[model samples]
Target: MTTALPSGLASAGLNAGEQELLDRVGQVARACAERADHYDRTARFPADDFDDLFAAGLNAPTVPREHGGLGLGPLSRDTLTLWLVTKELAKADLSLGRCWEGHANALVLVDALGSAEQKRRWFDGVVTRGEKWVGWSGEPQAPKPGEKRRFGTSVVRDDGAWVVTGTKVFATSATGAQWAILLVDTEGPGGARHAPDGRDSLLMLACDLSDPSVSVDDSWWDPIGMRATVSHLVRFDGTRLPDANVIGAPGAYLREGWQTAFIPHYAASFLGAAEAAYEYALKYVIRQDKVADPYVQHRVGSMAVDVESAYLWLRHVATLWDTGKREEARLAGSRARHVVEHLALRTVDNCVRVCGARSLIRPSPVERILRDLTFYVRHDNDDQVLATIGRALLGQEHDASFYKP
Candidate 1:
């Protein structure tokens, strides 16, 4: 609604073709919102939604045409395009928007780090063939007591092949996907997996979900929000992956390259969620004509300010993507995520107060938006990001490492 739209966000990073493709994606997602709950209620995958995205050729923007995609090169190409697209889809339905996050991560991996054969072999599957998968963030085996510090899966080299045995608890899209980019234990006797000191390692594996070595047992996914996301346990027995499936050798998984490269792709979903809350609140209050009252106007104005701030912060972060600052992106990612999501909840809560219990009704548009925003605001992973920023301000590497990329 504001001409203040981050200027050139579309043209600078995308071609005319890509812009057209993004428009088509937005249209299709708008149409599919009606059916999102049908799948959500049944705990079924949103196949028709995926079909719509695939038909629109919007599976992953980062994959190259040589591999059968738009070749947009991650969030860097058209940051606003990626931001708007993900937010619009999420407004329609979070589960569908969320599944795309995994696909985007995989695409970034294939484009940024995949070997030539990987591009040759699985590139088309991602773009042209519509191969979809989820990243393994929360999935972990039962870490012995407090061993949650380690990602439970293990990838041990056996002769020329790799054998993987572990369980991914609460793995999203557990039975529906053909591949998973799982984290694994690659620390050797030295325990130096990352710079400075850390015993943990990250491993990204392209595994066969169809093999008997993989079993999806006990779908323990009763949640107050993000329902219909059938996040369950996926167990990997003594399964063998061709050594080629290992990404970036044995020890490079947790470094700045792999982690930072694909991290922001998941964040589009969070930004989208927060935006949904803001948009839903704004529309509800205006439609109800609640703004006529002086108190209501003041409250509505506050919410508008919050909405503007969230998008403004988002576009600022988008600017970072425009500049291609990959190595120093960690703290920026954390701060942007926290700020946008915070504004989302604050905006939604204000709107809910303005709308009263009507906002809390079953399937109330604002109610669902509020729930989604709450969950979005809570996705804090490693607590080191804020700590790192604080340390950098004090010029103390002993406290943390900071990147300026």
Candidate 2:
């Protein structure tokens, strides 16, 4: 029997064409799930899965309608559809969902902050040429105390072109991607700001990864879970980019809302993996004729509750975003992810207990899903997020923003 999503997750206000598109995504997701184990075992890029996504036009769903794309909005009812899409992909393969989310995020950032020409170029690259892209925001912290944290990758102007240098850690899906939306520090050795008043010095650039100066170091990415993401360390040494590659003014990337908006995607991913584990455990119990056992039913009941809670959190997030309560949405997303993180851990543990030792062995979908989720849920600093939410409750100074760009 085919595994179905938990009750009430079937639709998200999608029209006929959009619903058809979602069905296509479901087909692609199942295909990816079939190969997810191979990619994770080898720690390699799932090129076949990405090829399927690109061929199905899933790569540019958020690009504006005028740009010849699906035109899903970031803060509309479409947000629900995006959540469902991410959850469906993640249910099949967490790593694939991560990379695809990054690709979709890059497109959203480019459309939101890129110039008209930049939008035309980047959106066309995805919609027409089927070029894969990744967004890199990870940066090394400042080495010394009392130093303000900034993007370690520094870009400087030389003879009307921009030269970029620095390393980005955990650059997921960098292997197959041809383009990157990078957040870099513009104040190079000369300490010059792109704008007056010394504000907004952080620059966001659309870079071509095919540049000889850009190198991807795969040696650093051996992790316990989410291995199929291929999130290797990417280094850019003296890479030159054109003036047109600059996205909006310095710091526009952060000011634009993608940072806060992306939290629910993480929640959706964790929730999906947890739900998958639940389904696996449920089926295992049935197959073993253990459904009549009270202990098995108790564990199943516990997992069911957690899964239902996660779904409600995700739906609330979508509703908040649709109503233009962005700040509330961000906070809700943080709380949702924090709670879902623990819920996933608990659900997966219950699955292991229910399925017994045999399911832990290789080639079992449950085993791979367990490992993938074990690592994927450690995203964003949970402690800090909780403290921030606490501060908000106390009416103290707190920032709802997850990323500072």
Candidate 3:
């Protein structure tokens, strides 16, 4: 059954390359949605979906031709292309959307940070024959010296190489990935505002997961939603990295400016989830005889407005990002992602309310959405962000200017 989107999408033209990529991505999405139920039911990983994704070079969107990509292809900056594409994929299957999100993060790291030589070597591996999926593994201490591992694990230099120790939890697909873009503390000694660990830290290192030091534990994620993510614990017991594997500058990963660009790529994942709910809910509610009642129509009507409002907000965020409004982008990026992620849950809640018990039935797409959206809605810093945004608006110390470049 064809799923109707919650509202109308404006007619827009995609130049040749843009349209082509979107068209091809759509086919993959169709296949993924087709298999979402079975995968969710058995808790099976979406291995086949990824195989197809790699074939399409979706894993390395920004890798240049020299390193094996479509070579800095044009993704429409105005529209929510990533969101739209991801939503389609999520509508078909959220697991695959998730798997690709991690891959996309690695690709962004490689494209933006990898050294020329690193690009030549690793990006080639990804493009020529599709390299293994990459994971993150750096967890520097929170500045106050009391916080446990937060980001990447540890960065210890050994024999002109880096030996990293620490595990990065919430690794989405560790069991299947071949490589990982790790975060490490290269500045072994120093202190700064964000560098509370006295480790002038943060390095994006490429790691070969085969090293004996790295171990992938059994999948332990039993969540209220998104049950098939295969998200599990990864322990790096002093995993070592070659000097050449360092992808970016020593301190670039967590730098203030980095969030502006890097976070949007992930934001699309939530937008996709929200869009998927919007897309699927339309078809779902319409087919249900129960929702035809007046009170139910009121609920569905609100969902439609929320979905459209959310999309416009997303596009505005993307526009700010493309136009180099970095500070605004950062704030909007946070807000956009927050709205997208939360709206997704709201949309799903509407689905459950409108569709009733059918949404709870096993193997149903609505149930899968409940799982996926719930996971995204749990992202950190909502109250703090809102307080900061409010303070800035009130001409207090933490104004928008505080985030402005």
Query: Model 2, 1-405: lDDT tens per residue?
Result: 333446445564557876887798899999998998899888988889888888887867678878877776473347777777888888888898888788877787787777888888788888888888877876645444764434357777898888988777678888978998877767542111122233467677788999899999888678998888898878889999888888888766545545667777788888878888898898888889888788887888889888878887888888888888877887888898889888888898999988899989877788888888878876677787788789878998665555221
List runs of model 3 lying over 4 Å from the truth: 1-13, 42-44, 70-79, 135-152, 186-199, 290-292, 391-405
Deviation in Å, model 2, residue 341 alpha carbon: 1.6
Q: CA shift at 339, candidate 3, in angstroms?
A: 2.0
Comparing 1 with 3 on lDDT, the higher-scoring candidate is: 3
TM-score of each: 0.84, 0.90, 0.83
Best by TM-score: 2
Taking the tens digit of each residue's C-alpha lDDT, what string does model 1 give over 370-402? 665565444443355566566666787622221
- Choose 1 or 2, whichever is better by lDDT: 2
Which ten residues in a row are the worst by lDDT in model 2? 189-198
Q: Rank the candidates by lDDT, best first.
A: 2, 3, 1
Candidates ranked, most accurate by TM-score first: 2, 1, 3
1 against 3, candidate with superior TM-score: 1
In candidate 1, stretches whose alpha carbon ends up further than 4 angstroms from where it belongs are: 1-18, 73-76, 139-151, 188-201, 381-385, 397-405
